[model samples]
Target chain A: SQQGEEDPQALSIQEGENATMNCSYKTSINNLQWYRQNSGRGLVHLILIRSNEREKHSGRLRVTLDTSKKSSSLLITASRAADTASYFCATERGGGTSYGKLTFGQGTILTVHP
Target chain B: EPEVTQTPSHQVTQMGQEVILRCVPISNHLYFYWYRQILGQKVEFLVSFYNNEISEKSEIFDDQFSVERPDGSNFTLKIRSTKLEDSAMYFCASSGGFEKLFFGSGTQLSVL
Candidate 1:
């Protein structure tokens, strides 16, 4: 089952623009992670933000998590044509056999025009 | 960077026929998992395995589905009787820890 719902099902922008996608999830989570999937390919782990951490960054990607609102956002700085892909937010619920299972969001599809 | 590897990039089988999907997780990773994504849908978790036993599974994983760590490196998901709805892209993943996961390219199963 899906635990999170991403807003803006699709987005189109030119290169060099920043793209932001939001995700809202139900239930408390130990961590929220973002992944990227190229068309017809596997998912690539992008970043992970623990429940205690508000924000985290890796390279051009930034992720923010807010447990209070049960929401999170992913930001791609200086987006490029190569950054065009589907982004998904996955949550790992806290405790009780939730260990390695991840519930993913519907995903946001971003198209970067070069 | 080691990766999780899945075999038979694409499989076509008739409904009611049994199918087996194979995966080889990173050598050092202890946790293994199976997930499926139907075309144009969210990725759904199927099962997770650790210490040679199933740690958790979703309701979607009925009696028809079974997982096996047949050897030290190979993990397999077997569907006893495939249904038309069983068609989807199945991904195998592994994690050394509980947070970050490495996913395989996936196997696209088509049950006709």
Candidate 2:
């Protein structure tokens, strides 16, 4: 399977603490995206980092990609209870008719207690 | 902000029955896609449509599955015969290019 794997299948933290998750992929990719899915809800796009990018930030969320390691990490600063959800990393391959056809990772489930 | 929209949030169907899940992608987006997630499984891409044609599809998308842009605004996925394994949460996503995707609240399909 071309799917990626995320580390730390589950995490729990108190509100205001930072939460971090890691993802590793096997193939060359054009870009990697992070998405959040609340329980029984649709995925909400969080951020996207291209293969050439090393780090990116959106609000309190920070994403870092290391091509040499074929891995990426997502950090949510000052996490709140509302930040509790399953986070997934999806990689878009480079070749073929790769029009946003993403291979998703086994997500990391995060729980932030208030 | 524009967003993708899917109809029939939940559908319970019997085996061998045909089912069509509907989606209305963002108006300005040019690409549409279908993805599925079985309970606790990673999201898997099924097919992608662009310019009213299928641009990419996964092996999981077999002959029994079909996609259509019936009108200018809607995209639909049709499964000829439902199977127990077909039960999953189907998500419809649209993208302007490749930056980020807008996803709709998925349709939970339960096949019995």
The lowest-lDDT stretch of 10 consecutive residues in candidate 2 chain B is B95-104
Looking at model 2, give its docking quality level: high
> lDDT by residue for model 1 over A38-71, one digit each (tens)?
9999999999999999999999999999999999
Residue range A68-99, candidate 2, lDDT tens digits: 99999999999999999999999998566786
- TM of chain B, each: 0.98, 0.98
Residue pairs clashing, model 1: none
lDDT accuracy of residue B53 in candidate 1: 89
lDDT of 2 at A24: 95
- lDDT (Cα, 0-100) at A10 in candidate 1: 98
Alpha-carbon local distance difference test for all models: 0.94, 0.94
Question: What would you estimate as the lDDT of candidate 1?
Answer: 0.94
Q: Report per-candidate TM-score of chain A alone.
A: 0.96, 0.96
Q: Write the per-residue lDDT of candidate 1 for residues B1-112, one digit (tens) a residue.
A: 7888999899999999999999999999998999999998889999999999899999999999999999999999999999999999999999997579999999999999
* RMSD values, in order shown: 1.0, 0.9
What's the lDDT for candidate 2?
0.94
